[model samples]
Target: MDFQKRHALIKEWMREAASMILASFQEELTVEVKTHRNDLVTNMDKAIELFLIKKIQQSFPSERIMGEEGFGNQFQDLKGTVWILDPIDGTLNFVKQKRNFAIMLAVYHDGIGQMGYIYDVIEKELYWGMKDQGAFCNEEKLPVVEDVSLKEGLVAINSGMFATNRYHTTEMGLASSGVRMVGSAGIETVHVASGRLAAYLSYSLCPWDIAAGKVIAEEVGLVYKKLNGEAVDLLNNNGIIVATPKAYQEILTEYLLKK
Candidate 1:
C-alpha cells in the first residue's frame, strides 16, 4: 500500500493548502452564513477544499473524498480508501481571529484510519499520525498524556455544551483545573493528544470535525468516545469526549454520567 509514501503525499498536499489559506488573509473574504449567523463559510474554505480534492484525485484517483465544504464525494459506506477533510476548521476563528483555525484531513482504508493530519496553519505546527507508528508534532514524537485526574488537568469544552449545561458541562469545569474554549475541535484535540490539555468535550461534531483528531488521539493512547461512553460513530454528529484514560473515567462518572 506504500503507506509511508501516502502519508508523505498527504502532508505535502496539506502544506500547499495551508499556503493558499495564508495568502487569502491579505485580501477581503467572501463570507456567507451556512446554517446560521455563527455558521460561516469563506471563499478561502471552498478554494482550499477544491485544491486539496484536486491534488488527491491527481495522486490517488481511486480514493473517495468526503469534505466539509461539499466539494467532494458523497458516499454511503466507508468500505474502501477514503479521505475525510475539514478544509478550514474553526471558520469563525479564521474570519475573526485569523489565527486559531486549522486544516485537518484523515485517511481511512477499508474503514480503518491509516493516517491523520492536523495543521495549525498560523502556528506552523503539524500534528500527524500513522497507524501503529505514533503521533507527532512536526518532527517530534508526542508522548501520551500523563495519567491525570479531573482536578489536576485542564479541560476544553465547546460553546454549545457550555451554554446548555449539556451533561453537566459547567460542573465538569468546576471539577477540572479549569475549562478552555479553543473554538476549534482540531486544535483542542491536539492539545489533549499532546498532554497540554487533559480532555476536550464537544456537544456536536460531524465526522470531518473529529476524524483527524481521532486518529491522532488513538495513536497517543487517549480515549475517544461519546459523552455517554459509547464508541464514536464516525458518520454521526454527536457529543464527543476525548481525553487521557484516567480523566475519561473520572469525567464520565462525575459529570457526563450524572443527570
Candidate 2:
C-alpha cells in the first residue's frame, strides 16, 4: 500500500472536516444526549462523521470505518484496513469552553495500527504518526520521549479515575510531581506522547478516544497498555494508561497491580 499517499489523503480529509467543525462553532449547535446528558452529540458531529464516511467510502470502498457518531461501518473485527474516527473528542469541552477538543483519526491494518492523526482544533496543531516513520507535531519530528519517573514527571488523569480510585490511580497521582485532568483524552495522550506528561490514566475509553493517540504514543517509545497492565484490545471499552516505559512499569506494579 502507498502509505504516504494514504496519509496525505487522510490529512486532506481532516483539514476539510476541521473547516466544517470550525464553521459550526459560529452557528448554534443542535445538541442531543447519546446515553446520558453529559454524553453529547451535536449536529456538527454527525455532519463531520457523515462527510468523512462518504469521503472514505468513495476513496476506499472495501475498507471499514468506525466512527464515534455511528455513521460508519458497524463491523467489530479489525480484519482489514480500518479507519477509526472521533470527529470531536471532548464534546463537553467543545460546547462549554469551545476549546480543548480534538479531531482524532487512525488507520489500522489487520489490527495493527499503521498511522494516526490527532488535530487540536483550536490550537491548529496536528500530531501524527506513521508505523515506523516516527511521530510529529506540525512539520517538526517528535523525538522519542525519555522514560521520566513518576516522582520527576507530571501525570494526567480524569475525574472519574480519581473519584473511583480506578486502578488505584489516586495513589499513582500522589507519586507523580503533579496531576492534571484535561477533559480531552486526545490532548492528554498527546502530552504523554510528547513527553510533557509522564503518564496519562483514564477509565473507560472507547477505541476512537485512544486510537490515534496510541499510534503516536507507541511511535515515540511511550507505553500504551490497559490500566491493569494487560495488552490493550482495540475493540473493548478498556481502562487505559499511556506513559513513559519506566513510569508505566512502576505504576502498574506499585499501584494498579499491587492489590
Candidate 3:
C-alpha cells in the first residue's frame, strides 16, 4: 500500500473531523467520569471519535481502529493496518477554553507508524507526518530538531508525571531551561515535534495521546522513548520522553536518576 497516499487521505478526513469539533465548541458539553474523577470524558469526545470511526470505516474498510472513546476495539497487538485515535486529547481545555484541545490519530502498518496527524482544533492548525517525509505544520515543512543539552532546553510535563515516583522527572525537568504545564499530552507532543520545547515528558499515557506525535517526532530525528531509556511501547500506556536525539541522551544520563 502507498503510505503517502494513505496519509493524504487521513489528513483530509482529519481536517473534516476537526471542523465538526469546532461547531460544538462553545455549547455546554456533557462530562462523565471514567476510572476516576480526574479522568474525564466529554460528549464531544465520543462524537468526534465516532465520526472518525464512521469516516475511517467508509474510507478504509480494512483498517482496525483503537481509540480512546471505546468506539474501537481492544487489541493485544497492532498488526496490519491500525488506526490509533484520540478524538479530543484535552477534554478539559475543550470544556474551558474551547481551544488547545486537539484531534490526534495515527496509522500504522506492521507495527510501524506510517502516518500521523494532530489538529489543534481551535487554531485550525494541522501537524502531520509520514515515515520518511518528515513533519509539517499546516503547509510548511517542520525543521528537524537542533541538538540541545537538557540543561539548556525546555521540557513540557503535566503535573501528574512530576508527582509520580517511577522516575526523577520532576527534578530533571525543573533543572532544564524551563518547564511548561500544558495539561494536554497531544499539545505538548506537538510542541516537541515542532521544536518549541526540547522535550515532552508524560507518564503512563494512552496510545491516542502520543501515537500521532511519535510519528512526527521520529520523522524529525527525535527519540521517543521512556524515562529510563526504554523503547516506546505502542501497546501500553507509559511514561514517554519525546526529545531530540541529543536531549534524549542527556536526559537519560544526567537526569532521571534516583536520589
Candidate 4:
C-alpha cells in the first residue's frame, strides 16, 4: 500500500481503538498486578489489544505483531511487516490516576520503522510519525530538537534512577537544572518529542515501551540512543535514553558510568 493509504487506515484503526479505550474508562475496571505493585494490568488493556489484533488480522493479515499483553502474534523474526504494540504503556498510572497512560503502536518493515503512534487517551493527544514525513502532535507539527546546556535542560528519568545505585542518575540530576519522573515512558517520550525536556533516561524498558516514541522523536530530529550512547535497536529492551544531541553528548561524557 502507498504511504498515504496505509496511514489513513492506520489512523482509522487508531480511532476505533481509542473509542474502545474510552468505553473502558467509564466503568469499574478489573485490575491485576503483574510483576509487582508498580506493574499493573486492566481489562481495558486486554480488550484494547484484542480490538487492535482483530483489526490487524482483518485488514493486514500478513503482518506479525508483538504486543505487551499477549493478545497479538508472537514472532521470532522481523523479516516482514511487524507491528509493536502496547495497549496501555503505563498501566500503573492508568489504574491509579486514570491518566498518563497511552496506547502506542509502531509498524516496521524488515526491521525498519515505517510508522508510529502514541495516543494519550485522557488528554486526547496523539503524536504520530511516518519515517520521512516528520512528527505531529494533534494537528501541530513538532520542530527539531535544539542544542542547549545541561543547566538549561530538564530531563525526565525513572524515579528509581535516583533511588538506586545504577547509572548515577542522582549525580546527573544534580548537574541538570532539574529532573522529573512521570513513571511512564510514553509520557516521558511525549515530553522529549515536544522539547519539554531535553532528554529522558530509563534503565529498563521493553520494545513496546519505547518503539513508537523512538520513531516520533527521531523524526523530530532528536537522538534515540541506548544509555551507553549507542543506537537503539527497535526490537529489543535495554537501557534507553532519548535526548537532544547536545544534552546526550554531555550526559555520556560527564555524568554516566559512575560505579
Candidate 5:
C-alpha cells in the first residue's frame, strides 16, 4: 500500500470535513438525543460521517468502514482494511462551546492500525501518524513524551468516573499533579501524545473514540491499554488509559490496581 498517497488523501478529506463542520455554526443544527439526554447526534455529525465515508469509498472501494453514525458496514471481525471514523467527537462541546471538539479517523489492516488522524477543527491542528513512519502535528513531527511519573504531571480523567470514584479514579487524580476533563477522547489522547498531559483515563469509550488517538499516541511512545493493563480491542467499547510509560505503570500499579 502507498501510505503516503493515502495519508495525503485523508488530510484532504479531513480538511473538507472541518470546513463543513465550521460552516454549520452559521446554521441552526438539528440535534437529537441518542440513547440518552447527554448522548447526542446532530445533522452535521451524520453529514460529515457520510461525506467522509463517501470519500473513502470512492478512493478505497475495497475497504470496510465502521462509523459512529451507523452509516458504515457492520462486521464481527477485522479481517481486511477497515476505516474507523468519528465525525464529531465532542458533540456537546460543539453544540455548547462550539470548540474543543475534533474529527477523528483511523485505518486498520487485518487488525493492525496502519494510520490515524485527529483533527481539532477550531484550532486547525491536525495530528496524524502512519505505522512505523512516526506521528506528526500538521507538518511538525512529534517526539516521544517525557517519562514523567503520575505525581510529576497533570492527568485527564473522565468527569463521571472521577466524580464517582470508579476504579479509584478519584484517588488516581489526587495522586497526579492535577486532573482535567476535556470531554473529547481524541483531544485528550493527543494531549498525552504531545506531552501536554501525563495520562488520560476513560471509563467508557467506543472504538471510534480512541482508535485514531491510539495509533498516533503509540507512535510517540505512549502506552494505549485497557484499565487492566491489557491491549485494547479495537472492535469493541473499552475502559481506556493512554499515558507515558512511567505514568501508565504508576497509575496501573499504584492507583487502579490498589485494593
Candidate 6:
C-alpha cells in the first residue's frame, strides 16, 4: 500500500495542522460545550478537523474518515480504509493552558491499524508509528519499554474516576508510586510509550481518544486493552488501559479484577 508515501503525506498534513492550531492562539477562540460544561469544542477544533479531512479526501478519496467534529462519514463497520481523527485531544487544556494538547490521527485498513500519529503542537513533537515499521518521536525511534511492575512506577488515571474511586481506581493509584492526570488520552498514551509512566487508565474513552495512541503505544511493546483485558473495539468507546506488559497484567489481576 506504499505506506512510506502515505506516511510522508500524513506527516506533512500534521505539520500544517499544527501551524493552524498555533495561529489560533492569537485570535479569540469560540468555545462551546459539547456534552457538558467541561467537554469543550473550539472553533479551531472544527476548523482543523475540516482542514485535515479535506487534505485526506484530496489524496485518498476512497477512504472513509471519522472525525470528532462530525465533519466526516458516519458508519457502523470498519470494512475498508478508514481514518480516525481527534483534532484537539485536550480542548480544555488548549483553551485554558494553550499547551499540553495534541492532534491525533490514525488509519486502519479492514479494521487493522496501519498507521497512527500524535502531534504535540506546542512542543512540535510528532509521535508516529507504522505497522511493522516501528514507532518514533520526531526523528528518534522509540524502543520497547521496560515491563515495570505496578508497585514500582507511577500511573496515570482519569481524574474524576480516581477522585470518585470508580472501579477502585483510587486503590490502584495507591498501589502505584503515584498517580497523574494529564487530561489528554493522547499525551498520556505517549507517556506510557516513552516509559514516562508505567500505565494509563481511563474509565471511558471514545474511539478517537485512543485510536492513534493505541497504534503508536502498541508498537513500542506496550499492551492496549479494555479494563477486562479484551482487545479494544475501535468503533466504540470503552474503558481502557495502556501500559507496559507486566504492569498491564498486574493492574488487572491485582487491582481492577480483585474482589
TM-scores for all candidates: the values are 0.98, 0.97, 0.94, 0.95, 0.99, 0.98
lDDT for each residue of candidate 5 in 4-44, tens digit (9 for 90 to 100)? 89988999999999999989999999999998887899999
**How many clashes show up per model?**
0, 0, 2, 0, 0, 0
| Poorest lDDT segment (10 consecutive residues) of candidate 2 | 69-78
Preferred candidate (TM-score higher): 4 or 6: 6
Ranking by TM-score: 5, 6, 1, 2, 4, 3
lDDT of 1 at 115: 90
List the candidate 5 regions with Cα displacement exceeding 4 Å.
none
Q: Say which prediction, candidate 3 or candidate 5, comes out ahead on lDDT.
A: 5
* Off by more than 4 A, model 2: none
Looking at model 2, residue 239 earns an lDDT score of 88
Better of 2 and 4 by TM-score: 2
Model 6 scores worst on lDDT over the 10 consecutive residues at: 166-175
Tens-digit lDDT track of model 4 for 1-259: 4678777777887778888877776789999988888888888889888888887888788778899998777666778888899998888888888788888998888888888899888888889988988999988988877767667899887877778846878778878889988888987998888888988999889988878998898998887889887777765787888888888888877876544
What is residue 228's positional error in candidate 3, in angstroms?
2.2
Off by over 4 Å in 4: none
Give all candidates' CA lDDT scores: 0.91, 0.90, 0.83, 0.84, 0.94, 0.93
All-Cα superposition RMSD per candidate: 0.9, 1.0, 1.7, 1.4, 0.7, 0.8
State the displacement of the C-alpha of residue 109, model 6, in Å, after optimal TM-score superposition: 0.6
lDDT of 5 at 27: 100
In the range 103-211, model 6's lDDT, one tens digit per residue, is: 9999999989989999999999899998888899999999989889998889999998898997788888888999989899999999999999999999889999988
